[model samples]
Target: MNKIQQQKSENISFNYFSLLSLMFVKKYNIQINQKNEKNILSFYS
Candidate 1:
């Protein structure tokens, strides 16, 4: 209700969003790397 509380809430939400974004990015990176590997293998074959 107060300014301090509102700021705290905003900080928590921001942290949650950042953590989710980081996890999503990590998963995406893994998928991209796997796809690259597959492509390289196919190209060689």
Candidate 2:
């Protein structure tokens, strides 16, 4: 009973952590893409 509750809480926390990391990764990717675009434009110029 108590163990089950603890397990549930752990699962919830793990899920939340993954969601936060996913958002962080998406933001990082967008930044990288913007940098790449700037590099490409500079190269053409």
How far residue 5's Cα lies from its native spot in candidate 2, in Å, is: 0.8
Question: Per-residue lDDT tens digits of candidate 1, residues 1-45?
Answer: 699999999999999999999999999977887879987678779
Give Cα distance to truth, residue 27, candidate 1, Å.
0.4
lDDT of each: 0.91, 0.92
Local lDDT at 1 for model 2: 100
How large is the C-alpha RMSD of every model relative to the true structure? 5.7, 5.3
**lDDT (Cα, tens digit) per residue for candidate 2, span 1-45:** 999999999999999999999999999977887879988678779
Q: In model 1, how large is the Cα lDDT of residue 38?
A: 81
